[model samples]
Target: MAVHSSDYPFSAFPSPLTTSPKVPNPESQTPSPAAAAAAAHGGSAKKRKSGLIECQEPQGGGNSAGESSLDLISWLPDEVLGTVISLLPTKDGARTQAVSRRWRPLWRAAPLNLGASSDLTDQDQKRLVFVSKILSDHPGPARRFSLPCMRLRDRYAKINGWLRSQTLTGLEEIQFGYEIEDPLLHYPLPPSALRFAPTLRIAYFGYCDFPREMAPLLKFPCLKQLNLCGVIVLEDVLHSLLCGCPVLESLLLEGNVGVGCLRINSPTLRSIGISVSCYGTRVENPILLQDLIIEDAPCLERLLPLYPIRGPLTIRVVRAPKLEISGWLSDSITKLHIGTTVFQKMIALSLTTSMRSTVKVLALDTFGPNLDSVVDFLKCFPCLQKLYIKADLQKSRKNKWSYNPLDPIECLESHLRQVVVMKYWGMRPDVDFAKFFVLNAKVLKKMVFGCINNCNDNWMANQHRRLQLDNKASQGVEFKFRRGSCSISLTHSRHKQDDPFDSHIFADDA
Candidate 1:
């Protein structure tokens, strides 16, 4: 075959050309044996020189065979690849299905890194399918799976199947957030799925519903931590479900879904955090707390009784050692929390925990009802060190002291070391508490008056100015006011339409 120069022009050479196979051009003058043999195979070389030689096309990307043989995700270095794959929204990632069979399975192999975010777009479906398929085909269990904003019933069914399929492999963590439309049909966890998910350690459910039966809980004996946010659960079913999980250590419940008096009976419970909000209508139903019977949790260490119903919190923690709580408090117990309603519940706390010796940190909303109650709380915690009074003096509750109000708790002035007056406007009571601290606490180191609301009045500003100056003048009782720590905005009131400043206002999480 006398191959001519016109037979294969230079234009036919591969774009971004490479001469690797050592094929001699037949157009050369010498009839070398190699050139003749190469010419014989030049047809294959020409096909190779055409666009077919590209490992990956500039526009189309991976070729069919390359796509079939190469696992796109597998070609990705294990550590760096997961990061790259995670960027593709589930929907786009699942489009790997069209890439090749190898990549189809590779997309499924990427680790499920679910974050706690509410943002979900239509593109998330592809990535979700990739994750679902991977979990389905995976030989073992998925350690972490986050399905946020999962709304469809079919998706739930597939997820339920995926979870069941992975049961023997041991799922470590599962987070599911979905809006429940038809509770019975959409949110059913089969008995097999539940029983097999014994390896689950942490589970978070958002805007979900648990049926009255709660038969699925019998299988969750290993569940240690559970977070239920924006969930409406039946009262009777809640108690039964909680009691069934003997190993439950930490529990968090937020928002109101009609949960009355929570009677927790878990023996292994170490910490309990609750934030229950009560936003009522015109009709006032008595704020009822799900009764928290303390007799059950013997090993309980930290108890956070957050915005419970407007009632006395009766946690018989005479048994548990340490308690850490926050939010609106009733006087039935004396502890650390924000707001003054704790003073209302003060009378109950006085009679209950009289034996308690030390309260190291105390944050008060503002003195309320009885100065004697304040004295009572201080007296009970004789070894108190840090006292934080987060009071809005402009919103102070009025009460006429019957006895010499300042005399009994005069010891507080001497014993307390650190006293913080938050939202201070340098009112008489504010000055009085500050002056009392200056005169009493002999070893007091720092006295901070945080004035969130700016006091333009010269006299009010000078009062704090003088206190700081006078403290410097005397034995140098260090006094300072750090600005911008809190907002000066007026809070909305439920009582008066004209009066925006309602001093009696107590935040639900007070």
Candidate 2:
């Protein structure tokens, strides 16, 4: 899936200086038309006529056989040709015209996938020209367009004009974001941009202010995935926008300023991610969003609120019978933070309700692994399969659960398959906690341990020796260890479970 710049469709074409004339062997009885033409024009004369002509000239008699022999790939169907060109970058795809006259038309009609990164030198000017030329000359359907973290102050008019063009009618995905350094600058999205593309399925915008006047016309009938990061928009405007997309599935709102409260009632919405800024720097008087009410969304699977909810926040899951995976769930709202208390409350609440059987995957951030508390916490989710625990092993060890040799948690003996422990240090509490799982958890397949900040050879060897001493209940269980400046990540085995919510708790802070 990694794309190399040198692997472009037409990048292999020989240069004029390197291309040698096809010399007709005088010993051969018969000569091809191209060879005959080369003889007639003289070898040196044919060499002087540019690489394109020399490479594309028909051999034999310019018939089907000649065309097939000269350029077999050109004989490929137009649909196939377009597909091949579409895989290349926009600039590279455009350069295919130099390959042959047959490719010129194919390149013109190929589905455009334009992407320009800010890291590229003179990217702003180059993007403007490149986009302008592609849109103006080709006038073909575009599939994806991305301009991430670019300076768009001077080129906004041109970008707006291009978005308004009819060539983008077939666009399915669009990602646009402004320069990160300029926080005060806000680029307003043109109404015509989204309005024209009924085929748009995914849209991501960053640092762009939503125009309130165009809220009514912001209907995206085919949009399924929408991500608005660092964008300023009112709660009502966001509600109106979501209301229009009857089939919106995945939504990610990160560091959005204006929206105080979020209410989602879409039956088609499956995954919702919200990360509100607690710094209180963006908006003058930011609303302390009180409630997040999910109504009538039976298909809702993943609900991830990444950061801690600043003020008194209430989350109510209503009419979502199929709601399964919820990130950072808590019973009592103590600034909506992640800890042992929050997890205890969540499990307790689930145990008291019908969500106990439905909830499968759980992610928690704990101070340290307390065996009793962990067992009691997990007992609530009867069908729990995957458990992600981020614990600081350096903290003090505490035993919350009374060790009972006869009794065991039902999940560990049955459903639990994978366990991922992050930020693991070679401490007594960490080893003891891990040993508890090793000697228990009949169905456990994999256990991963990661140490982010410190990973000395002594620490690793000691932990390995300690864990291996304990007889693992599951013979198939595998242990993985990763240590470096990056976050430590460990997983026992790979399962085909569908994880809708991507954990960003560590990612945001790390």
Candidate 3:
């Protein structure tokens, strides 16, 4: 991310240039009146001629001061000037052309990062014309071009025309998204523009449609990230586009239809995010997505599905040993929806090896009817520290604690330190669960009760009073109460190491 002036050189200026004139020896030459004044004013004489001074004394002691001298910034090296102009906004950078003739070529020669929106100005047509003019005037390849959150329905042809004229061989990133005018409309992308851009590394398109006819020829050999949000394309066309990207590392698809199933077979892919919208009102049809098959992705780390799959949704991972952090344990498993079969498998996996203790933090949606099943699951992870219980009030109201008080869980007595019980309404089961941890967890340092519904000040006070009556095993346990629900931590404080899978969860959770 570091930017250096040497990286962006001016093609027209081959040598370094400066505006400051060489200074004469102070002892040999008599100081000018301006230099004398500067010396009297506590400024160096050479700083006056270098355009560092803002104003000079009137020639004959007149009342008015003389106009400011030429800016020394114009004399800066082309590389420095290019870096300065590149930081300016598109409109402000264009206006710098009027500053001087030297500045005119600097804007064109600098790496072009054009970003415009219709919301910036009242007249949409004028904005479009201004963007078109900039694109026409600058024929070089751009570094980044972004036109996000703009209304492009009427100006689709104009946008396509502007894109067609661009030489995007060196373009690194491009983002185009339509405004919230019409939700279902899909703007067609220029096929020629995409086909010619061989150096594109990141591309994001919203409310757009891909050309089916050019799917076979679509190839972005250097593309590492591709995001298609609210885009419409055929199943085969989507597959063909994915097949063409040989080294893609991240792929995100949200609200995309016409593709029932996705099969990713990339060797370099590391992250994937998918969110699908059901087709119709009938639950039977339910977007018949069969399986998301991932194969040969040894570096794969993150897999996220935004919504819960309603139909037969299966995820099959092949040849990805790193998918699980250690053995069958995953350090990034924040939220899990486990059934009886999967729960049994976890138990078997934990017992097979002593090195597979990766589940340090766990969040449960519901404790289920059997408390022993939950206790048995926790016994597998010997390094368990923090526990989150998102209690379903209705199910918890009917369930009862079935664990024997004589035998305490190993984690509760030794490893467990922090506990959070969310959606607490002082129900009998909820109070019992909270009391169990307070009384048994010898190492517990913090316990939080998050009240999300049906609990007011008096209710919280009463619950707090009841919980304090039980003598806690850990003398330093501090209790806290908040007004919101608990959120699953994708990365916990215990595990500060970077997890590649953490970035893909937001796309899936959204």
Q: How does model 3 fare in lDDT?
A: 0.56
Q: What lDDT tens digits, residue by residue, belong to model 2 across residues 1-510?
A: 333435333334433211222212222343432233344445433343443354554322223434434443443446655766665555555555554555556667778777665322244565555556557776768888787776666767877887877787778988887775554555777665666436889888877777787777677889998888778787898899898888898887777777767888897988777665632354567654556777678788776655433222566665666656655443333333221123333333233433546667776655566555456557756677887766656467764344464776778879888777766665678777877777777889877665664556776677778876357889898776656322322111111126632333333231
Count of backbone collisions within predicted model 3: 1
Determine the C-alpha RMSD for candidate 2 after optimal superposition of all C-alphas.
10.8
Residues 1-510 of candidate 1: C-alpha lDDT, one tens digit per residue: 233333312112322112211223332243332233234445543443344445533222334454423322223333333333333433333333333322344334655433322322234454454444445444443456566556656666566665566423566666766755554443543333344346778777666544556543555678898777666566776676676676888776665355676766666886665655542331145244444555556565445444334332444343443433222334433342221212334542333343243335544444332333455656655556566555445436432333344554433544566666666666555665566556556567766666654545675567756454455313645666655333222211111122211222222111
Using TM-score, rank the candidates from best to worst: 2, 3, 1
Highest TM-score among the candidates is held by which one?
Answer: 2
TM-score of every model versus the real structure: 0.59, 0.74, 0.63
Q: Cα miss at 160, model 1 (Å)?
A: 2.5
Clashes by residue pair, model 2:
33-60, 372-401, 446-492, 447-492, 448-490, 448-491
The lDDT of each candidate is 0.47, 0.61, 0.56
